[model samples]
Target chain A: EVKLLQSTDVTGGTFTLLLIGMIGTAVLLFLGTGWVSRKWKLPVALAGIVAMLAAAYYWQAREVWLTAGQMPVIYRYIDWLITVPIQVLALYFFIGTVARPPTGLFWRLLVVAIVMILARYMGEVGFMHPTLGFLIGIVGWLYILGEVYFGKLGEINTKSASETVQTGFFWLRLVVTIGWAIYPLCYFIGSFAGGVDEGTLSIVYNLADFINQILFGLIILYAAAKESATAR
Target chain B: EVKLLQSTDVTGGTFTLLLIGMIGTAVLLFLGTGWVSRKWKLPVALAGIVAMLAAAYYWQAREVWLTAGQMPVIYRYIDWLITVPIQVLALYFFIGTVARPPTGLFWRLLVVAIVMILARYMGEVGFMHPTLGFLIGIVGWLYILGEVYFGKLGEINTKSASETVQTGFFWLRLVVTIGWAIYPLCYFIGSFAGGVDEGTLSIVYNLADFINQILFGLIILYAAAKESATAR
Candidate 1:
């Protein structure tokens, strides 16, 4: 029985570490892309502040997980704080690219930031399942996909009369969108299949989450490199 | 023991009825608001559709509660479905009003529709702990308050070169916001002071919820009257 318990602890610890790593890598990718965008005169640089905070949140959450034997209750609080910036930046990028006479990156980011702040409460109060943390992360991926689809990928050229959409990231966008979509559907289905066993559903959800995050990280890296090269 | 069981049945039956009524009201409010927005050249009529479906989900969830008699099991689903629409519409209305601009009637009716939705969800899920529902409901109320504060509370004249914000509904917005805010805080404090018995928490929460719905319905009626007078 002691051996079994130790093994269980090991598994839980590893799983927690993996989730922390995914969140950290996602934050880095966001900052990296924003850096490239800033170099190109796009307003993405301002949104990078959100990315930095998210990285810090993941770092704290991971530390808590490593030290605390029980799930750190405060991890939820950190989860919420991190979600705010990501949501804001994601929506900012979306609206900035779509605006006919686009407003400054400020308004778009502000709106998204507020929405995310509100969403944080929803998650914190247990209004939605904590697993939603991973789900909300997909918004970042969606923004990237939207930018690529609309050919607004990379730095802005104010001197140019009109902006054109880029096609290089089409396949990358397709893969990410499809992958993120699957995570939610799997979650909904898993909820029913797992029934009253919260542990079972959490395991299934986390495994799918691990796969999704790794793929997401790869996509971000690919897009960042592609956009950087195009800039050169 | 038999009398106690009878009391339980009676309360459960009443809860079910109230839940149905709240959902019915939500659907009507959603449809009515959609019709009005469409006529006003606002493209957010689809958001109204999504909101209505979410209300329907709440409706079904309440039915499950009435039948299942197992609060934990039924509530898990109810909480999930309700949160989606609340979050979705919260973001939708914020962006919609900012983007398309709407008349005073839109904000008023939206508050009503959202309150109705909140009442039903609270009745079913938060009935046992009204403070939770009340706290969640306040988030929605604040969004409307923010709208009014930002001056998105008036009619849009499509032909005009620029739109103007109106503040005629200032008092109405204030009353609704304050009233909703009080429910959660009051109930929470009351529950703590009175001692945290399950039955007591349920009663306080349910009573606060009923008051919220009644206030919401009144706002809708007021909005409808204002809209008619303005049209004439």
Candidate 2:
């Protein structure tokens, strides 16, 4: 039988260091990407997703590390509220960087992100029944997920774009689809059984953010590099 | 401010009749469609989705009508457990009925339906926190929606198939995507607000099943007939 592992203060320190390393790496990459291709939108937006996520993660990690005993759950939600929406915007920029961007896509994506993030926040903060708030949030995530994989990214995948563009879109969408799914799975794990406690949840979340925020950024960087190389 | 609408016993009778009417229609349509197209798989699967949904709805309606005051929520989950998996099959048949069906498509779709439906049941049954259940279900749903719209249906839409096949998939997919979203929305609404009682939820559910089951079947019938005409 699988059991939930209770993390100790030592493990907490290790995770905090990891979080700092993630943030420092993200900042360095963001600055480097910005310098490499300020002219391109995708890389800039990719940098933006990492920037906010790193900030959120770093801040939360510090707060949790400094405090003793059980960490405050609200810190995680605060990090998510600040970073998750920005991540959605990064996805938006993926489509927008292409010429003749779809009309109303930006606002629509933003609305979904805001609704999802806020509804979840409300639930976490006890403004409503957690389940119902979560349901609303799920509804919002469904809308964004539908538009991303089914609607926009599909268009990008099948369009008459060049080989490099198509390759970039294919890999980018794959990364987003696969990597982002881990967040919710981890969420379910945390919420479902008595086995996984807050500390493990934090570790898993921090690790996931490291991948989703940074590894996700790697795809766009490659794409931007390809785009810039051809232009020069 | 929006408030949840409570339903009364008198209204309950009307919805019970509606449920019976829905079941009766689905039965009649199933018989008629079975006679019309035994050779085709899509219509058969469409018939199956309706047949189970009608039976589940019919059983639940009878119990509620007889019991008067209290309702067992498990009946609804039972219904979903039986019907939703079939509904996924209906979606698969939409693509499966086409020439050169994709590899491993059936198992993937089944896995998604099972994951989605079971997670929902666990949440409703209080076996797990509803939020985690909802998230897992959403994950399943997003996967299915992605495949149906962006992945497979898009392929069905663009391929050099006969006009009849394309039209069938077009209408089928639209009905599935738009019509199915409402069930989750209503579910969230019912779960979120105390004002909307189970009766109103049942009424809305019966009404939606009619559209989703019978009305959805009608489209498949047209497509089946068209397929038959071309076959001859």
Give the per-residue lDDT of model 2 (tens digit) for A72-182.
556666666767677777766655556545768877877777777677678777888777777887788778777766787557556736676667666766665666666
lDDT of 1 by residue, B1-232 (tens): 1112244664455455556655565455544543332222111222222333334333443444445442332232233233333333333343343355544545454565456445535544435345555555656556555654553442232222222212213333454466456545544464456645433444444444444443344343334434434555
- In model 2, pairs of residues that clash are A4-A195
Calculate model 2's interface RMSD in Å: 22.1
In candidate 1, stretches whose alpha carbon ends up further than 4 angstroms from where it belongs are A1-232, B1-10, B37-172, B194-200, B207-232
**lDDT of model 1, residue B123:** 44
lDDT of 1 by residue, A55-155 (tens): 45444543454455334334434543554445334433433443433454445445544454444345556887645743564454355455434533333
lDDT of model 1, residue A33 = 52
Across B46-163, the per-residue lDDT of candidate 2 in tens digits comes to 4543553555456545555454544544544545554566667666665555654475877788788878877876776577788788889888888888887788656765673768
lDDT of each: 0.41, 0.62
- Residue A62, model 1: Cα distance from true site in angstroms: 30
